[model samples]
Target: MRVETVLLKDYTTLGVGGPAKLWTVETPEDLKRATEAPYRILGNGSNLLVSDQGVKERVIRLGGVFQTYDLRGWVGAGALLPLLVKEAAEAGLSGLEGLLGIPAQVGGAVKMNAGTRFGEMADALEAVEVFHGGRFEVFRPEELGFGYRTSRLPEGGIVTRVRLRLKERPKEEIQRRLQEVDQARKGQPKKKSAGCAFKNPPGQSAGRLIDQLGLKGLRVGGAMVSLEHGNFIVNLGNARFEEVMALVRRIQEEVPLELEWEVWA
Candidate 1:
């Protein structure tokens, strides 16, 4: 394991945050060392909001062997979701194409049940291997208690790997499906912003509600709601963490939608 002091802004898609001490763990020994101390998991650095004051605990990131994966079976927790989608499409594997365009790592995606209207991570997940309570244990989908944009990964458990069950489709067909999903995602903003600021809240669309409330283009200091998508709050170059949170609070006051991203306060 190795440690570094860094500006947390550089690690998030939002381009905001303060300084922190980060620890990158490689093998099980490294993970064990990290577990021995109080640390927070850094998952892909997307869909997160960190306070400008930063965090007190050491941040843990998975690396080395944990970044590796197998197409049909076990996959490292640190595997990139977009890469997984591309590999699945190229390998003629179906199911994962629906998650194309999501910016996330395997562990984060599963922990939050990440997905689009096409499907969620729970749809293809079979089981997971996690290290907790001084030992490694396997947890099945039934035990996960998966929900919309949420999952129970076992308290204090660090996900090491996961197993997926997918169907075989024609490679060309899966590739085409990926393209379609990408096109569907074109409406998402290209600026620096955490994917979506709020969950859709059952059958109602959070974005539509925010738009209806005329909250788009709203600004709090350097942070502003995206003109293209009401669900996104973009960083106007120098947005601070609290500036973004201010807008989040404003949106919640105007609507009942809950946050889709994590707030490191």
Candidate 2:
């Protein structure tokens, strides 16, 4: 176990957060020990935006043994989703190709049901092993209440492992599908960002609405709406959390449309 004061921006993809009390746990025993303390679970920092004021709560990040997995589809929560997709494809497992580029760990991905138009984490998830109430417990997919970019997993619990059900498929076919998905994602901005800023309202695309309103390229401090994709708020350089929120608020207030934030602060 490692404990230190770390800048949130240094851990997140957005690069815009204050310092936080970070605790690194490398094993399930360590994680169980940590549940007795006040802490928030943090994954790979792919889909989060911490506040500039920072957080008083301690942060726990799974690592070491948590990043390891077996070919039987039993994976530790800290395993990278992209790596899983690649390994699964090579192993002729066909279920995670649509999520090839998502930069999330298994725990966060399961928490958010992260996915694309092709499929979601819930599609292949059989069960989740979580550290809760000072012990480990397994919950089935139906218990999670998986929905679009959301889940009903209870709070105050940390995911420890995930079981997936994948079918056998040709490696070449999986690679081709992965290539197609990658090509489709090219329009997303390459700037420092936390992917999409808002959830699509029902069937409507938040990006399309923002683009239609000509909000692209709009800037607030070092934060700006991506010209290539309106749904993305990119950090030009040295962006502050306030600047990103300013842009987000402006879009919500001016667009006269309901926008649900995808970035968590």
Candidate 3:
């Protein structure tokens, strides 16, 4: 493992951020050491929003051993979410169908409790493997206290892997369901994006609210509110972090001012 300075723009799906002090780790030993420093573990960079000023602390990104996937009992948190879901589905495993469109690694998904209409990671997660204070621990779902778009993984605790308990279903049925989810995702806008920009409110959808406010196609520099899905902010090339932030702020401000509904960024 080595530490270096890397631009966050290249790593994040949004393609809008400054350089960050970066560190790359692979083995559990490396992770244990990195956790001792002021660091943030980043995976896939899907739901993350880095400041224009860039992340100040050491940002640790897992690779090599950390990215390996094992479905027997535990899976690496750094493994791609799509890959994990695909493997599960192929093995006749149920659950994780709604996460087909989500672009993130397992660790990030667990931290954010990422999910969609069908179900969430919390529903399938049996336990989470975490490294903290130079030791590893496995926390059950109840201990993690997962909820809507959030989890109770303590701050500074680095998720190393996740153990998921899946049910055996018909292989054909699993593939069919995966295809259905994938087809639904195709209708969304095609561009570089960080999935959804804002979380959905209690009752209303964020995309619907943004569209109702006539914010589709709205732009700030090269960042634009996705015309197809208002909840997504897409980068049209050469977009800056400040532009995305500005657009988010505008949407948050206008949605409440015009619709009397508060939209948190």
By TM-score, who's the top model here?
1
State every prediction's TM-score relative to the real structure: 0.97, 0.96, 0.92
lDDT of 2: 0.86
Pick by TM-score: 2 or 3, better one: 2
- The superposed Cα distance between candidate 2 and the true structure at residue 68, in angstroms, equals 0.7
Task: Give lDDT tens digits, candidate 3, residues 1-265.
Answer: 9888988878888776677877789888887777776877778887766766787778899886888876768788889998988888888888778788788899888888888877788988888888877788989989998888887887678788888878889989988888888887776777988888777878878888889889999999999999899888899998877787788889988865222111212
Instruction: Give the higher-TM-score candidate: 1 or 2.
Output: 1
The candidate 2 region of ten consecutive residues with least summed lDDT is 256-265
Worst 10 residues of 1 by lDDT: 31-40
Candidate that scores best on lDDT: 1
What tens digits encode model 2's per-residue C-alpha lDDT throughout 154-183? 677788898888889988998899999999
Better by lDDT, candidate 2 or 1: 1
The superposed Cα distance between candidate 3 and the true structure at residue 212, in angstroms, equals: 1.0
Candidate 3 runs further than 4 Å off: 256-265
**lDDT (0 to 1) per candidate:** 0.89, 0.86, 0.81
For candidate 3, the per-residue lDDT at 50 reads: 72
